[model samples]
Target: MDKIGFIGLGIMGRPMAKNLIKAGYAVVVCDVNQQAVEELRACGAESAATPAETAEKAGTFIVTMLPNSPQVREVTAGENGLLKGIRAGQIVVDMSSISPIASRELDALLREKGAEMLDAPVSGGQEKAEQGTLAIMVGGSAAAFEKARPILEKMGATVTLVGESGAGQITKLVNQMIVGINISAVAEGMAFAKKAGVEPRRVFEAIRKGLAGSQCLEDKAPRMFEGRYDPGFRINLHIKDLWNVLETSRAVSCSVPLSGQVIEMMIALANEGHETKDHGSLGLYYEKLNNVALKEIQK
Candidate 1:
């Protein structure tokens, strides 16, 4: 296995990088969080101070799981950026959920430097990230996808090459749109169950195995029942993804009114300082509107 440079050590990135290390890859990590860097170092990973430094040290592959397009741009093209150190034949696999347009532009920039880029975003939230069972959707050259499959498989159970340049990020936008809308629907239904004086858990159990059941229902309904708003995936980050969805939709002449509504509800919750809370807090939005709490009502 080649030495891999992994950047961005936040909730998803940290565990994904650790899995690469566990798989016997010589990993070099870069992050602004010194504590996260030290923690990974303790796990036998090397550390780099900047994206450029990481690229220089890791040589063949550099992977970034950053927050958004701006962050990805800065790390790849700004001062001490990866473009400075990436060589011809080196590939940068960006696993961040960012704008598909931006992903294409960045790929072009890397090509100018004789390097290649792959837009490979992932799903399955923090739990699956820790378990190394994420579903990765990739968009890039077929050859590059083949070369990077083993490395991606270390962090994801399903790795697929979807299309070229920007398709992976576009597919992720579709994923987020469905997720955001489904979460809102779940929230509304559970709140309705509570207001109707039925135990939300009972309703969930009654409907979970029927055609109404879904992965979102399975993952988030329990969190709603328990009122656990811990960050499996932050409301703030989901908001970012939805907003990107809207922007991309506008560019391609598509309508997403449902996503727009969910974004509004999430923003309402964010204004109440629940931005950093789990996205399952969409349930809390219904709770507030209906003047009932899911946890308290269940009790």
Candidate 2:
């Protein structure tokens, strides 16, 4: 087992890195957050002062769980970046959900330096990251996928190589689109039920077993009912993902009408300064629209 260099130890990254450490891999970590790096270090992982340092000291694999396209681009290309210290044949697994176009650009940059890249964006949120049961969508060559699958399996429950180069990010954008749409639908339904003087949680239980049922309803409905809007996956991040979704849609001349509508609603929530809350907080937007507040139903 080669030593893995891990960067960007935020909510998702920290747990994934910890899982790697627990799985008996020698993991080296780097992040802007010193406490995050130190936390991993306490778990038997080595800490690097920078991405370049991690790449230099760690083995053939580097995993980055960054926030967005620009950050990913910067961390791999900046002065003390991954490319500065990478050797030929080393691989980069970017688990961030970002722009597919940007993923392709990063792939080209890595290939130019005689390295391989996999855009392996993950879903299933921070809790999944902690439990090592994330759903990882990978896009890269078959060889690279095979080489990376074992390491990926350690962090994800469902790992699949979907296509080449940018497919993983494209997949992630699709995931975000569905997520945004689903959350919005749940928000709308719960708000409507509350406005109609029906218990939204009871409505959730009734419809949850029918054709209207879905994981979104199951996972997010209670949160909306309880008015808990803490950031598991921040609404702002979903907004960013939708931005990528729309940008990529325009590039390919695809019409994402529902996605566009959801983005508009998300932007409304963000502009109102609710972007830092969990995406399930979308119900608030509907609550405002309906002029009704949803009360938590008795379990």
Candidate 3:
């Protein structure tokens, strides 16, 4: 088993790293949150003070599950960086949902240093992360993908290598697009039903078994009716993803009117202080506009 160095021990990263350990790998972890570091250590993982330190000790391969492209770049571009400790044959696999263009750039950088890199982003929110059943989309050379397959399997139920560098991030963007659009439609439908004097719950049940049924509906519909805004995935992060969608669309000369509209609504929710709430809380916008609550929000 390869010694694994995992950086970023947040909601998703901690669970993923734990599963690697559970698979009988020697896993070392590092994070800015000392509490998170200690928690993983308590599970039999070693802790490191910095990315460089973790890379040095666990140089077989490193997995970064950070929040964004900027943080991923920051972790690899300096003295206290992953690349500093990466040897000629080491692999770098980033599981962050970030820009594909940036992923490609990082791939080139790692290759120049005689190492390999994979842009392997995941779907299935926090719940699935804890369950170790995420669907991972990988983009890298065939050899790199093959090398990372066993490691990826420990953290994800389905892992597919789609194409060359950046494909995984592009796939993740498509996922966010579909997810954002579905949540928005669900919110609007619930709001319209409530204001039209039909019970929102009943309306959900009726359509959910029809052509409108989806994983989004099954998972987020109840949360909508209950007005639960906890962060399974935050609205703020969705908004950031929409920004990426718009940028990617512009580059491809594709017009996505619906995604554009949803982004504005998400921005509206963010402006109203629901940015940190679950993306399902998108219903809050419609509730506010219609002067009705989908369900009584628990205080």
Candidate 4:
């Protein structure tokens, strides 16, 4: 197995990197969070002090799972960045949810150094990340995709090369757009049902197998009913993705009214300090609107 350099060991990144180690790859990791790095180090992975050192030590593949475009850019191009030490023929797989435009610009930078970059973002949140069942979407050259496929497969159940440079990030934005909208719809509908004197759990059990079913509904509705708002995916992060959606839509002269509305709901939740809560707490938004709450009803 090739030596892998992993960066940004956060909620998603930490588990994904650990899966690579479990797959028998020699992994070197870097993160500002020393505890996370130490945790992976204790799991038989090596640790690096900086991205540049990580790049120099890794054999071919370097993966980054970060927050947004700014963080990704800083790690890849800032002083003491991976670009400082990345060599010819190296492949950088960025799994961060960022701007497609930024992905393209970074790809251009990597290409100029005789290296390749793949904009590979993922879905399925923290749960699937820990289970190594994320759905990864890649955008880059076919050759790079093939080279990275084995590494990706170890961490994702579904790894797809969607299109050329920046395409994966665009696809991620689409995912976020639909996810925000679906979460809002689920919250609104469930809250309405509860307010109308229907058992929210029964409503979920009834419609979950019907045409209204979705991954979002199945995952989030239960969280809503249980009143558990832990961060499978945080409201603030979804808000960030939604802002990217609206910005990209504007760039392409497209309109996304539903996304616009959902973003407002996210902003409202964030304003109320629910930003760190799971996006399933979108139910709280509707609950407040209707003056009703979603609590665990006996199944």
Candidate 5:
């Protein structure tokens, strides 16, 4: 029963940490938000004053589910960061969506300090986080993956070791690219259905059982119909992921035409102030473009 340090208690982080605790892991928690720290404390977690302290208490296994690469750097390399306290043979598993190159650099830096790094970015949104059914894509040495697997199993349904040191981030970038493009296509399909005098829900029902169906359509189309754009996964986060994908693709000299277009559309939607909404709210952008109010469709 190894002790664990869990950092970053935002929408997905909080639930994932909770699952680890509920599975009987001794979790030491930290977050910049005092309220998030307090919530974890109430759930039987020990609160740490800083990432370094958390690392000191947990010793070898630390998990961070942060917002982005910069935040990841701040927690791991800042003055009071985790690296300041991490010792030899310790493992730092970063489950944040970040660049593979950044993960590779961090891996090298952490290794110099006698610690190992793993990029284990996740998918399936907040709902899956709460359910402990996330899809985790891991990239690290085989030994590090073995050390982290048991704990990761508590937080995800499908955990895969895609490759070594930054491969997980690459896989996650591919995941986001397909998700962004598919969700946009779903939005466009819904809009087409609405404009053509077909019942949007029926259109969803008809196509859902056909070749055009997808997990995105099944999970997000109903929410779009109900106008429930709650932030299971924020629109801005997808925009950030796309930005990472664009940069990663450029670095590899790869062309992702659909990914590029989807990124631009997400940027436009975010610029129009839908950043805080759910990614499914792209449907609203399509609705507006076609001059069809969501309420009108419900009638």
Candidate 6:
């Protein structure tokens, strides 16, 4: 089997690397967090001291599951970046949610060195990542996608090659836009139900089978009702995702009226200090606006 380099061992990255290991790949992993690297090393993955080391270990293909574009740049550029040691015919597949423009720029840079790049951001959150059931949106050359398909298949249930360079990030931005708007809508709906003396849970039960239902409503409404705001996906991350959408929309001269409004509301919520909370905590914003708490309604 071919060796693979995996970088970023956060919530999603850890499990993703694990699945690759379980699939019997020769996986070499790296992260800024030594502890995260140690944990993966314990799971039969070889440890690389740096991103460049990981790239050198797996010359043909490397996978990055980083946080944002800046982190992506840091890991792929400069003396310490993966590109420093990467050779031609090698491929770097970024599963990080980043701007399409940034991905395109990186692709150009990597191509100059005889390597290829794929913008292949994923959806389905940590739970799906842990279960190896993410939906991966890929954008790159057809041959590059084919080379990376088997490895990507181990981590995602749905892996699609959307189009050429940067299209995956574009698709992921679309995914985040809908997710941001949908979760906020779910939050407001739950809040309205509580304020109207209806049990938020029962309200979800009623709409869950109707046209008003959505994956966001089912996944987030219960957490909103229970006031469980643990960070499965942090609000700050979603805020960044929304900012990407807004910025990309502006660059393309696209008018996303509803998405723009949701981005403003998310910024307001984050500014009010909900950035560390789970995005489900957005329900609390509506609660504050209405001066009615779900806990009070439950009583």
TM-score of the candidate numbered 3? 0.93
lDDT string for model 2 (162-277, tens) is: 99999999998988998889999999988888878888878887889999888888888988888888987888999999999988999999999999999899899999999899
Candidate 2, 63: how far from true, in Å? Answer: 0.5
Q: Indicate whether candidate 3 or candidate 6 has the larger lDDT.
A: 6
Q: Model 3, stretches more than 4 Å misplaced?
A: 296-299
**RMSD of model 1 against the true structure:** 1.8
Cα error, residue 4 of model 4, in Å, equals 1.0
lDDT of each: 0.93, 0.91, 0.88, 0.93, 0.90, 0.88
What tens digits encode model 6's per-residue C-alpha lDDT throughout 1-299?
98999999998999999999999998999998999999999999998888888889995889999999999988998567888889999999999999888899899999999998999999888899989999999999999999999999999999999999999999998888888889888878777877788877877888899998998888888777677888877888888887888778889899999888777777778899888888877787888888877543356
Better of 2 and 4 by TM-score: 2
Candidate 6: which pairs clash? none
Q: For each predicted model, how many residue pairs clash, with residues at least 3 apart or on different chains?
A: 0, 0, 0, 0, 0, 0
- For candidate 3, what is the total of clashing residue pairs? 0
lDDT of 4 by residue, 221-240 (tens): 98888889988789999989
Q: What's the TM-score of each model vs. the native?
A: 0.93, 0.94, 0.93, 0.93, 0.93, 0.92
Error of 1 at 181 (Å): 0.5
RMSD of each: 1.8, 1.8, 2.2, 1.9, 1.8, 2.0
Report the lDDT of model 4 for residue 240.
Answer: 91
Best by lDDT: 1
**Model 5, range 156-239, lDDT digits (tens) per residue?**
999999999999999999888988899999989889888988878888888898888999999889998888988877889998
lDDT of 5: 0.90
TM-score of 4: 0.93
The C-alpha stretches of model 2 lying farther than 4 A from their native spots are: 296-299
The TM-score of predicted model 5 comes to 0.93
True-structure lDDT of candidate 2: 0.91
Error of 4 at 83 (Å): 1.5
